[model samples]
Target chain A: MSANPVSRARLFGSAAIVITTLAALIAAVLSIGPSGLVWAGIIGAVALGYAALSFVLHLSYPDAAEAAWDEQNTVAHRDSLIFGFWAVLWVFLVFLALSLTGRMDPAMAFYWLGPVLGAVPPAHYVVSVLRGRAE
Target chain B: MTTKLIVHLRVYRAQAKLTQAELANLIGVSRKTINTIENGVFTPSTTLALTLAKALNCSVHDLFALPE
Candidate 1:
């Protein structure tokens, strides 16, 4: 049988998380200063903590780990995408409004866009879990 | 009138003496998926409905129905 769509989405989400974290880490490292060091440390700790948690969960609950990307998860992912689209659009609109009023720099608005867009999936997943809608 | 899909999955699963996790394993899904379907909180796809019916040794109609 073909792989579940939820499973595929989870794989891509995990990849996105890793890539963004790596990019942030690289950017932090390239700029050397106390602030840069602090950002790098914070990012490193978060990445390591996530990896450790996933490893432990996989080892401790093999069945749950295997089932993590099931149909329920797919439904949650789909809902999250809908939520994310609206959220991103709202953020863009707000930024556009501010830029037009000369209250915010367009470049600054664009800089914040990437992180906000990247945050949607994980934020939605957390909300779903809290609502007991997704595993 | 809005029609809701009424799922009889729990009754059949109970008759088969299978736990949610067991049925999930049989159908290659998660226990959460089985639980949600049983509670009528989530509707399974056609493919999943067929797989669940096959796993439970029943027809899709037997496992699910709409109120008349």
Candidate 2:
């Protein structure tokens, strides 16, 4: 059986992500020291790996990729955003409390918040999709 | 009167002799969208309902109803 052609949009999106992430990694590492290089390396590796995997999935399973972009998935995405909002709010509250008590550095809390914001929505989205598939 | 949205998409699609994927393609959506609508996991927009009805050769009222 012939494999379905991959979506051009998906291909270009993956390529863009990979390119932007690499550029950001190089800029960060050049501007910062070894510590920043370590963090940037980890983040860059994850971004690159995810982009590659997404591209491969779009290429290998065109039907599933198409399914993931439809209305049901949009509903799932909105639900995940709601979930992420509450989750991040709770995280912010916790960090605020810790900073108020002088238990955590405000700078550190602010630093970690960026990753929390980036991670929560996609994590919730993945979970929501998995739950929907299971049901 | 209290009413709940009731969907009969599966029945209509079956009567129309179309699979979920086929119905989705007819309506320019994905199979999972049709599956979720059929299983009551997702409530489609009015536009989607109308499109589905058009594709299935039925009315929206035939595919969905609000029961009192």
Candidate 3:
């Protein structure tokens, strides 16, 4: 939200990390090679580090971070859930049609469902921000 | 048939010389929350509305009003 250079730099850095990590994850899953474990380990380590940092921040800066978290949980999360509703519906409908037409397996639809639904929030956020309509 | 909620938060925020992020920090909300509330894309809860009103040095009714 802060368009200051420092804040923008930090946001871009964080986004870069997320993008790279996700790309690695997808490649790992697709290839199922030895690097898969490496990628999984990296992701696990990042998750653990993030959790630890968040715990520390919550403890140290209880008011600021917790308030933000509360707002996110109550407000942003509610919006995300609404978006997820339509996202899941449309995704399933499309996938169902694809499966019925013998293009994709029905089981794959169920398999991809959670990830696709999960992506809706970040996707919406990114698109909204890019379009300057996030507010 | 029902009228949509209209928020005059941006005017108050401008008068207070506060950016959305600054006001959000003051009221302990995410900037996105403040931005959305100002743009009328989202409405604040009662507590948040009161908090915003207090921070902006205005009454709740002064901060948010019907279009009459």
The candidate maximizing lDDT is 1
Give the lDDT of residue A106 in candidate 2. Answer: 96
TM-score of chain B of each: 0.93, 0.90, 0.88
Compute the interface RMSD for each candidate structure: 1.9, 3.7, 4.0
Q: Candidate 2's residue-wise lDDT over B1-66, tens digit each?
A: 544579999998898899886777666566657877888777888888988888888899999998
Any runs in candidate 3 off by more than 4 Å, and if so which?
A3-57, A70-73, A128-135, B1-22
Report clash pairs, candidate 1: none
Model 2 lDDT per residue over A1-135, tens place:
111233333333334443544454465548653454466466556656666867887777767566556666677667767877888799999999999999998986786565566556666654554565311
DockQ of each: 0.51, 0.24, 0.36
* Predicted candidate 3 versus true structure: per-residue lDDT over B1-68, tens digit per residue: 65567688899999999998888778777677787777776667788899899999998887777667
TM-score of each candidate structure, all chains considered together:
0.70, 0.69, 0.61
Off-target runs (Cα >4 Å) in candidate 1 are A1-66
Model 1's number of clashes is 0
Weakest 10 consecutive residues of candidate 3 chain A by summed lDDT: A4-13
Q: Could you tell me the TM-score of chain B in model 2? A: 0.90
Give the candidate order by descending TM-score: 1, 2, 3
Reference-based lDDT, residue B7, model 3: 83
